[model samples]
Target: MEDCLRIAVAQIPVTTDARANGREIRAAMRAAAGAGARLIQFPEGAASGYPSGAAKAMLAGWAVDWAALREELEEIAALAAELSLWTVVGSSHALTAPNRPHNSLYVISDTGRLVARYDKRLLSFSELADWYAPGAEPLVFEVDGFRFGCALCIEIQFPEIFVEYARLGIDCLLLSSFSRDPMFAIQVQGHAACNAYWIGFAVPAQCGDAASSGLAGPDGRWIAQAPQAATRLLS
Candidate 1:
């Protein structure tokens, strides 16, 4: 296992259009690959836009086209394979009728395989009541000797989750969010320091305007960060 691995944290624009979102994600993957990053972490709902405020009305009505979303995901996986880069993308996971979908992160390996999926377990009030079905399990995956745990927006409020991942022996935590709160960055840094593990915090470009997407080292210091209010990659 390699002792060092280069990972990219992406701050990209996410729209309601799956195709448009896929395009931006693919471009970021190419850039990260060019920068020699082995893995890239994207913001929550990078493929399918995250619903908020007025958008929640559309989500309550179940407006997403599941097929198009799946196609976009597959294309992203193919691109990850081509670049030999591990990719983590946030999207909605469809379930049977009468059941709400899950807010989740899809983990694609460098070999172009869907290795794992981490569904958001601790959802916000609106998410649990209307937008999504809460997930039951936590997820952890490995890359180049580094073990990584996955968490989504709002999960930052729960320190037990971070402690659990630490107990599971993960070296890093990948926390993806659709938040515009600067406190998100502060909370993630605290988690990194408490757990003695690196934290890759990815947020949408819109959110970056409030607090930049960044990578926090074990010492609770930023290793890299994207510029505020910009779509960029932090490697």
Candidate 2:
């Protein structure tokens, strides 16, 4: 364990194609590793795009290929091991038939092992009604002596979640979202300031127009940010 750590927050374009999305994610991981980052966080649903409106209809109508998605995840895991980088990537987790899948963040260790998973508990109305199954518990892990917590989009509105993470003694919060709201940036910074912990806010490149992916310091200032609407890594 070291006294400091270098992390990368990615802003990548997400699409309906799982393989295409996986390719972008892998590219970012390599870039992060090349930049000397030990850990990298990605946007919400980085592996499986967050479907909505027409996209939702398409997914619900047999557009999703779970097998392909699984293969992509395996490849990503292998790459993480090769690069010796820890990764937190958002994706959809399938369940037994007739039950909806969970919106989840798969935490891969530097050894390329699927160490843990954080499922999104507080889902949007549409997510609950149609898209995903709610998760049951909060997730926390440690790397290089720093404790980290995980949270997903929409969960930002819940103060309790942040407070709980603070109580759990996390040194940083890894929050991923697919939203394009400007307030998300402000709220994430506020969370870091309030908790006196760092926060990596990872959003899709498309949403960068409103709020690009960034690392917020405990002082509520942006330490690093990816260019607006661009696919890049904030190291």
Candidate 3:
């Protein structure tokens, strides 16, 4: 078990096109490898693109191609194998008839295997309550002797989740979000300091008003951040 770990925060452009998004993810993974990062984290809905209220309304009648989404995920996992890096990426998970899809984080190991998955437990009443079903369990995974926990988007507003992870003895907390508010950074830093854990926060580059993707130390200081409005990898 290693005491030190290097992770990357990927701030990539997300679009409605899953193919294009997959390509972007692949590019970021290559960049992360060059930077010697063992793991990379992407923003919420990095695979299928996050839908805004208006976009969700428009897509209400459209059919979701789960097969295509799975193919994209497989490609990402393959890239992880090629680069020998772990990845945490956000996407939608399909469920049975009548039930809404889940907003989930897919954890891919360096061996090109789909490892544990973390579904977002907290669904925002204003934004996702109607579209996504809430998940119940917490997700914790170990790498390099460090335990990592997962959360998504607006869930950062709730401190209980972080507290639970702290109690579980996680060394790092991963947050994949689509929020464009400045408060995103503040909340992340606060949580990291309050829990004495590192925080990896990822958000889309093109998200208006969104904070840049980056990693924060347990001291509540930012270790690195991608340039605002640019698709890049920050290690």
Candidate 1 residues lying further than 4 Å off, grouped into runs, are none
Tens-digit lDDT track of model 1 for 1-235: 9979999999999877788999999999999999999999999999988896455667657677778888999899999999999999999898998999999999999999999999999999988887899998989999988899999989999999999999999998999999988899999889999999999999999889888899999999999988899999988
- Each model's lDDT: 0.92, 0.92, 0.87
> Which window of ten consecutive residues has the lowest lDDT sum in model 3?
53-62
lDDT string for model 2 (118-210, tens) is 999999998898889999999999999999999999999999999999999999999999999999999999999999999999998888999
**Which pairs of residues collide in candidate 3?**
180-209, 180-210
**Candidate 3 lDDT for residue 145:** 85
TM-scores for all candidates: the values are 0.98, 0.97, 0.95
Q: Which of the two candidates, 2 or 3, achieves a greater lDDT against the reference?
A: 2
